[model samples]
Every structure is written in structure tokens, then in C-alpha cells.
Target: MKFLSSLFAIAACGLLAASVFAAEQAPQLSGCAAKRQDITTQIENAKAAGNAGQQAGLEKALSEMNANCTDADLLKQQEQKVLDAKREVSRRQADLNKAMSKGDPEKIDKRKDKLAESRKELQDEQEKLEKVQPDEDDD
Candidate 1:
């Protein structure tokens, strides 16, 4: 009977440990929150790389995010901004790819500029999303 009890105790401990691990791994943010975290990480990476131009752009984007993302009523607008930024990035990527394939210097340069603009837009939207505070009810 003692051996059986010991086994049960070990099993309970294992289950508790597993539950803790699962909870730790679970994502804490949804929607804009998650996007904001991703953008923040990218901004940090850019800063670490010593890319002054990129960092400046990201900082501007972060400022824009800070301004618009905090309002509860603006959630939908922020979401739309994110979607539009994503689409712009996709479009720019496609244009860049096409330009690269064509091997045209002028086209490539123009596409590269467009791609950079799109990237900045994406960063800005992400910053906005990140700045969104969790609803009071979420707690």
C-alpha cells in the first residue's frame, strides 16, 4: 500500500509540473498585442545591428503606434492599419522579386525604395498594435 501511494504522489507531481510548463509556453497576447511584441523585437534587432537609418524609421513608427494604439475605440482602425501594412509589404515584395528577375537596374532600385517604404509602414503598424493596452476585463 505504501508503494502504491508513493507512485500516486509522483504521478501527481509530474502532472503538476506538466501543467506549469504548458501554462508558461502558452501565448499571453492576442491580436495587436502579439504583433506589437514582434515589432518591438525587430526594432531591438535593428538597434543592435547599428543600423541608424532603420532604427530611426522604427522609432518614428513606434511613436505613431504609441499615439493611436492606446484608445479602445481605435482597435478596429489599428487592426486595419496592420492589414494594410501587410498588404503593402506583400505588394512591395512582389515588385522587388519581379524587378530582380528582370535584372533591370532602374526597376530594381525603384522596387527597393518601395520595399523599404513598405517595411517602414509595417513597423509603424506593428508599433501601434503593440501599444494597445489590454482591456480591463482581460485581467
Candidate 2:
């Protein structure tokens, strides 16, 4: 009886562990894949409803998503580029601050130009990132 009870306890613990592991393994959708699925569904629904205008728009969106989100590696690279751009902006801002502290007109102008360039780069990178990421509304 004692041995049988111990065996049951061990089995119960094993089952509990397995359940916990399974629960922890949530399904993660690939950015492009999810978008593709969503767009496909929207396209089908639009076609069913005979909404030609909406269908055209959804098709265009789907094509853009396919172009941007298909390559996971490219998406990751774009994300990295955005991070680098943000860092560059921060560095440029620091330089501008230093120039301001020095009270030199020429230095301040140069730093301001650099800062503008950095900000533009950051904005471009952010746009690229947005293209690869899943839209919040899609979720």
C-alpha cells in the first residue's frame, strides 16, 4: 500500500509539471504571417460582401505586408536599425547640449544640423519598423 501511494504521488507531480510546461508555451505568431492571415480574411470577407472598393484597399495592404513582413531576418535588421537610429539621436542631442553650454554660435549651428539629421534618420527607421511590425488594430 505504501509503495502504491508513493507511485501515485510521483505520477501526479509529473502530470502537474507537464501541464505547467504546456501552459507556459504560449503560441507566438510571426509578424508577417499574422498580418497575411488577417489580410487574407479581410479580403475574403470584402469579396463576399461585394465591396469592390474595400477589397481593393485590403489587397493593397496585403501586398505591402507581404513585401515588408515576408523576410523575418530583414524585419529583425530593420528593428536593429531603428534602435541604432535612436541611439544616434541621443548622441546628437548630447552633442547639441554640450555646444549650447559652450555658448559658441558656430558650434551650436553645426550641432543643430547634426541633430536634425539624426532625428530624420530616426523617423525613417521608425517608418521601416512600422512596416514590419503587426498593426495594433489587427490584434
Candidate 3:
């Protein structure tokens, strides 16, 4: 019984170490490579689920990414998204201010919600932009 328990414990430890090693060995993809991987994963899922329309769309998107998706272009697009998000946040802030000035509690609450959404979008865009590191050529 003691021998069996010892073997089981050793086996558990080995499995845990193997799992950790596998996770560590997986490369952390970023930029266009990461984007490609994501789209590919989606395509595979769509295919597996028998969603022909979605699979076709994902395939088209993957092809487009393959053809025209460059690191520089991706960086520029992410920057533009961040800029647009910022503009949207500013607009929402103005709307909220207007609503507050009118002293309408309902409108103020609605505008506040809109402003929060825009702010969150801006934050998400900023995070995405950070993930896309610019090449030296971009500088």
C-alpha cells in the first residue's frame, strides 16, 4: 500500500511538471502573428461546428490578412482605432456635460453610461495598440 501511494504521488508530480513545461514552451505570439493565429483558430472552430458561412468568411479574412496584413499597417490601424476611441470619448463627455447642465437626471444617467462605454472602448484600443509594437522603420 505504501509503495502504491508513493508511486501515485510521483506520477502526479511528473504530470504537473509536464503540463507546466508544455505551457512554458508555447510561444507567446503578438502583432500580426497573433492575429493570424486567432483567425486561424476561429476558422477551425467554424469548420468543426459545420458553420459553412462563418467558415467561408473566416477563410476570406485569413486570406486578406495573409495578403495585406503587415506589422506597420497593423500598428497604424491600431493607432487610428485608439484615436477614434479617444474622439468618441470626448464626444460622449461633451454630451454628458450638456445633459448635466440641463439638470435632467434621466438624461444625465444615460449620458453617463454612454461616456463610460466610450472610455472603456478607448482603454481597450490603447491596450491593443500597446500589444502591437512598432517596428524601427515606423520610427
Over 52-129, each residue of candidate 2 has an lDDT whose tens digit, in order, gives 999999999988877766556757888999999999999999999999999999999999999999999999988767
Backbone atom clashes (below 3 Å) for every candidate: 1, 0, 0
After best superposition, candidate 2 residue 99: deviation in angstroms? 0.7
Tens digits of per-residue lDDT for model 3, 55-121: 9999999999999889888989999999999999999999999999999999999999999999999
TM-scores of the candidates are: 0.46, 0.48, 0.76
Ranking the candidates on TM-score from highest down gives: 3, 2, 1
- Better model by lDDT: candidate 1 vs candidate 2: 2
Instruction: State the C-alpha lDDT per candidate.
Output: 0.82, 0.86, 0.91
For every candidate in turn, the CA RMSD to the true structure comes to: 11.0, 12.1, 3.7
Worst lDDT window (10 residues) for model 2? 26-35
Model 1 clash pairs? 65-128
lDDT by residue (7-106, candidate 1, tens digit) is 9999999999999999799867755455566678779999899988998888878777766564555577787889999999999999999999999999
Regions of model 3 farther than 4 Å from truth: 1-21, 134-139
